[model samples]
Target: MADDAPRRDAALVALDWGTTTFRAWLLDGTGSVLDSVRTADGALTVSERTDSARARAAAFEATFAWLCRPWLDEHPGIPVLCAGMAGSNHGWAEAGYLDVPAELSGLADRLTVVPAGDSVVHIVPGLRDAGPDPDVMRGEEVQLVGALATAADRPETVVLPGTHSKWVRLDGDRVTGFTTAMTGELYGLLMRDSILARLATGEVGPKASAAFARGLEAEAAHGDERGLSALLFTARPLVLAGRLGSAEVADYVSGLLIGAEVRHALRGDPAAVVALCGPPSTEDRYRLALERGGVSVRIVEEDAAVHGLWRIALDAGLASLTPTATPASVLTAEEQPS
Candidate 1:
């Protein structure tokens, strides 16, 4: 007689679907990544291609199926969990929000399920700060969960840098409140459409680090008194006066924007230590600014999304730690199970 048991170890399909990017990972029972994929099929892109809500949902479903076809075919009925704009009002399905003072552990229970072919995809809920100054975040919450899991000591503050930088305050596992700043968006505007763009000749190079430091110093000196508008205009004069190179304009602008954001964020919520969660590019800049502000920084990997999704899967009873088998194609020769 021949043995007829399951041979695949892939337990869950983790997705970090955002505004302009879609990333997925194949995780085994132990939360180790077996394979991964990334693309530009974001929720916004999918929605823009369809008009009606019904059509949009179908498109999202089709996109998910197409992206994870290989994994799904190899491991039928594998649990799928998604975090980010995919659960927003205009995305696949509105997963809703867990208002501030919300506990992170409760996230798994509030998931919204969307049926895609033979798989049921669970979407995580966004966080809402419904105070005098309102703010909302979709995908950063999962990063927070993963950051906390990997931290030796709990950080009072967690900053997620992106187009809209988020300053999140955590009291244990519960989120008390949070704020958002348009630092990255401002950098994009100034480097692309503003007057600074005309003078920006090439990519930010090694020499741009000095220019970036100058921008940080400039912002630190006059940002509070003269305001960002006045300080931003000085970039043009610096270039014309031969003080700043045309290629360095982008880095200088980035420094000014990130400087102001870090300064003000600290003033609002003073923290002795902050856990910075973002990609290497933004992480290096933020680490510089935060250290300059006299705050110790703890760095978390950008791939926190996969760990976060795995945690939620276990909490939701969607995954287990029991060793399992996975398709031979999904694993390298060294990763093959006995």
Candidate 2:
């Protein structure tokens, strides 16, 4: 095959469409990525750019066509599997949710189908917890599926850290329950508009690591008794007292917030080892926090979404493996074609 030749083995187009990021992968019969596209054309952005529901849907369709035109053109009738906010009520199609304790395998049976130009898109439904304290998640469910598939051991607890960090509890393939924390959102708010942001200067560097550790230690010690409000306030005073450098304030605050989240999450659902699935930077921070909380960590591949979409596609009969198809190992970040 030429470098630019169309892949006749392409079996599925996997999409991970979130609030502010869009990623699509063209996968072969064995789930190896043949081609991929990533952009900032998220569901939220697409919704905001349009007025009415009709316009919003049209915009989403147009965006999808624009991004995957080549793949759709070359491989007509190829199955497209999407997971995330794109299936939300306000998104291209309302895929709805499966209330917990839902079986992970059953997700393949409840896909929402949307006709986009000449292609049919299968959107994965989100998960919902409807007890006294209710919560819902859209995109993280697929990541969970991927994480479990690629995990060395099926973890009892899984943490997907992001803008809204998810702490998921699973028994085998069943998702018993989960909780969401506003750790990342809070960090963004404080860094962008809080009083601490005024004093924070310079990039977080090697010196910031010690400050971050201090914040985690402080949260572990005083977060329960003194409260997070008091712990966060101490950041300002430490800088004023010539103890913490201005540049280290961001990492210090990050440590405090992530530490508090980890401490509380572990207390609620203690586990021996937790599967941490996320980007490298976010995973590093959570690994530190979780280890500090005395739990062993197993890092799931960051590109778990692609693997997840592949699994769901196979189970749903949207795609199939060929007899001649050779299984390929998951590609690392550097190994993926640009």
Candidate 3:
């Protein structure tokens, strides 16, 4: 079988390539998952050993090979679509960002090809804000599309939280702009690495204590722009007062990180509803804080990557999500930054 030879596009694959983990999902024509796998084969993970880009791509290919062997034994060839850091500046190859203030529909049919096991693999490029407060995303654009695809109505602001959190504002379906928040890493370090580590020893449970609420209060006062020291102060103040327990302090620390997001980086249209489409735990914390702050919000779904990839794969013509293809809409006139 040749690398570029056409085969029956019966199955679709989606890759959520990240900095540390490479996750792959097999999907049927209707965007349902058939199989999912993760490997220690991310960009930085692969970079530790080899200097060749081709070798790193091979690592991804080999990982996919193991998963697709059975499927290929029957079909011979299948198309895989990827999104996220896998297409970053240092990933397999650069698939550069599409300009932002664009709509979710803009990414519908877009695709980028990468080397795979004698088959075609497409990596989805992230969209970056072109105006001031420049921000970039490699894979979340498709996820955002999934969020909108099943949304109640056009969203005003969509917050996707992780290692690098994003607050994306949309004008109807087209994304107007966004900002990145380092909430995930900051929360992890402050809880485990910093002196604040003394407050907690392990994972936080479902029922967060009063310290969490207190931290949320202080963080709400300062919001996203507040410095690290100030946010951590809530932990110090509570513990010193003999109020927050070692375990309770962990919740406080968690709340501090999320509260800051609610306080800052969430400036969307006053009327736009907030869409929480990431981790449920963080979404829970964000919801409480934002509601308290008088922001109208909704929790869209748990696994945005899968939903986003589903829509992306279908649009890229890899998956049979749609039967009769519709032409891409003429882009709404681009908006100039003030």
Candidate 4:
């Protein structure tokens, strides 16, 4: 395809509108990105501004119009598919959840369409594990579907490490069940507000250092999840005793948390090859811990948000509904940062 082609030729717009971040991609057929945009106008900000249901909906609609104006204007009448918190109860529209053991193929059938001026918007539903213990997830389900769509082997576990890390399991094409660990969130609390904040003063960057390796060793030696409370306290004591440096405390604490998370998640199957997805730095931490635990890792570098939306759009039959042309000329709206 020619690079100068009009935006009207876009296959569709893929949106990953989450709680704290909003990302959109203008894609052509075969799922190649023609253009992309990202903003901080996440659901949290939009939801906080409104009081009533009517006001909330209006707020969401207005936010969407502003965030997506340039792309929507460029590609008039194009279909838009979104996956994430944007479909949550607090978001633009509640798309609800699909129960576990759910097949990836069935995702499209549950899409909730809401009108957006001349364009059409489809919200992908979240997935739930309605077992003896009930749990729900809004966004990661889409990424799982996107990751597994092309896997050669039937992946048993897929780990998405972030603020709230998710460990998802699959039984063939169906998502069997999953679990979440508040590893990143805990790290934030400890490093930002807790007593350990002083020790984490310097930049640790991405690569794991000697101190990080020691933290992993400490976790391995501790060998019990219940002992994390005691382990966390070591950060201060080690620094006070001059056993661990103040600067290295940051990476050390990261290693400790990630190591603990990896051990807990793989408690069922230590040898399982886990598929990981996230930003490079975050995933690198998880990979270090997983490797230390003797678990193999596969980093999925593809844009899961885009791929997932595109796949679900195909399932919803909206990909075929994109108009070839619209009479209105593209609006020259200057893109604004959120």
Candidate 5:
């Protein structure tokens, strides 16, 4: 009788198809990841690398098949659930955007399915903020769905840190609104092109926690009329005056930028509970920034994309047609592996 229990087999393929990378995860009914795949076959790659109009039009499908060839050969006709830029206007196909203040369950209904040979591919739509100042997010919304679904508390702030960091406001299991900060992109420009570039040299590896802390403190205590622009000049002068050194400039700049973002996001209420998502490498830096601003942060695993795709697949009834899960199995790709 005990043996009669239904066996769980690998059910579906969860794909987080971004602008520069394509990541896949094999998941079971219980939402456990079985195996995974990652490739540089992203939306831009397909658009720029392919030759000819026919090839370019079929770029998404062709690149997908090439990357998942091995998996397709092994698993056969498993349904693929994709999220991120793959559904953007610049990707395989445009899935449009669902307005903010939307629920996770409703996201399934808006999925765009593209017939790809034997296996079907489903793309999750992005979210739009229909406010006075309009804004939109393509992929992070999927991760937001997954993060909110697993959270124990309601109405928590979720921060997805990257080239353009997103500060999302979740309320009653719905993503109410969000704001973006160009922290990472600015950091790159400063380190590569700005005056800070002169001294912010050397192999910048693991975060200089102490220097980062200093930056956070300085950013937090900054009381100036010029805002960040005025604050940035201090970096070079501190080095020349021996107040700050050359080697620590990068980390300090990172802290300053991240700290400024945190300070701005948590303005008016600094003690808010925040959930930090995305790559772990930047999580600690963000976590430190938030803490320095008197905010409490909970680090969410980077695999929220996998869970989000699975949940949407289930909601869209795509999971029902896929295979079943097999006992517990786990495999992972290093988040943002260098």
Candidate 6:
């Protein structure tokens, strides 16, 4: 509990750093979630550093220091792997994004470890495309990698549906690049806080079959980037014309997002391997959309992140598979009820 000493830890630190918050997972050797800390080390949140890279490393280290020695004693020589925005140009000494196939094939040895006191750190690179477009993402690849491995040669589109739902094409062990969609954040803002908020509430879905299907069809019919606005307008018109209920707008919202997602997945990568991660039901809707788009489908199990992190850990020097969970979290099941 010193103010200046290098606080020690015994667990591998797996950080899911994003633009808004930094989620640090203290994991045991066996890849289980032990204690975790949710800190406000997002890029903009730190004002002390002069440049983005310095800011990122500064934010990262501050959050890393919060964990104590007790966890470290139990899991010594802990290696760390960070994903998400933490690897952006603004993040700690950026590790370049790996091409699709190369990443999915499994990077058992391609971990980027940085110097941090006596311990070492690994940063997972974000995914970028050959196109000039600047859409990028990090850490999510670990989830996708996890989903691919868990599915065990299952041919499917691993969609990590989130603030930026990624439709990744995976054929066997190879991830043939992917596309990034801003569906999650858009939906949140539009339905919860935007002009559409007047007609919206927090009660959305568990699997809106009809609404989801309708959205998929709308997107397919509209085609390409324009599909987004078209779908939204269609829903608004439907609601105004008294053809759809207010409650059903959730479906309309869902459809708009998923419909766009399906289109992104089908055209994201030529590899045609899609898997769903993040929120559960969203994947099913994406699957239904894929089938409607004349695409095949498959399902991957949980622990994709943990397993993905494990692969990175092994590369970072994990001699054994000793993993366990310690139920310590910052948010309640309600504030972050999953």
State which candidate, 2 or 6, has the greater TM-score.
Answer: 2
Model 5 lDDT tens row, 167-272 = 8887776787888888887987889998889887553445448888888788878834557777788889899999887888988888788878888778843546
The per-model lDDT (C-alpha) reads 0.89, 0.90, 0.72, 0.81, 0.79, 0.64
Model 2 C-alpha RMSD to native: 6.0
TM-score of each candidate structure, all chains considered together: 0.90, 0.90, 0.83, 0.87, 0.84, 0.73
Question: What's the best-to-worst order under lDDT?
Answer: 2, 1, 4, 5, 3, 6
* Root-mean-square deviation per candidate: 5.2, 6.0, 10.0, 8.0, 7.6, 9.7
TM-score of candidate 2 versus the correct structure, residues matched by position: 0.90
Candidate 3, 66-138: lDDT as tens digits: 7666665656677777787878877777787778767676675556777675777787878987775677887
Q: Model 4, which residues run further than 4 Å from truth?
A: 1-8, 223-226, 269-271, 321-338
Candidate 6 C-alpha lDDT tens digits along 1-338 = 55643333335777777666677677755666768777667644543454555656766555555543444456656666777675667666577877645545345455567765555667777666666664666777777667655665665456677777776665566666567788777877778765566664445676656756676666677756565765676666777788877777776677767776666656645434445566565656666766676766665664577667666666656434653333336656776645
Number of clashes recorded per candidate: 5, 0, 3, 0, 5, 23
lDDT of 4 by residue, 129-238 (tens): 88887887888877887787656676788888766788888888788888888887798788889889977777557777888888888888894854877888898989
Q: After superposition, how far is residue 217 of candidate 1 from its true place, in Å?
A: 0.6
lDDT of 4 at 19: 75
* Candidate 1 local lDDT, 1-338, one digit each (tens): 23666544899999999887899999988898999999999887999978888999999999999999999999999999999999999899999999999999899999999999899999999999888999999988999899888788888899999878999999999999999998877887788888889999875543328778888899999999999889999989998999888888888888899899999999888889899999777888888889999999989988887888888889889898766556677998889778
Candidate with more favorable, higher TM-score: 2 or 3: 2
CA displacement after TM-score superposition, residue 100 of candidate 1 (Å): 1.3
- Comparing 1 with 4 on TM-score, the higher-scoring candidate is 1
Stretches off by above 4 angstroms in model 5 are 1-8, 49-57, 193-195, 202-208, 240-243, 268-271, 321-338
Better of 1 and 3 by TM-score: 1
Model 6 clash tally?
A: 23
Clashing residue pairs in candidate 4 are none
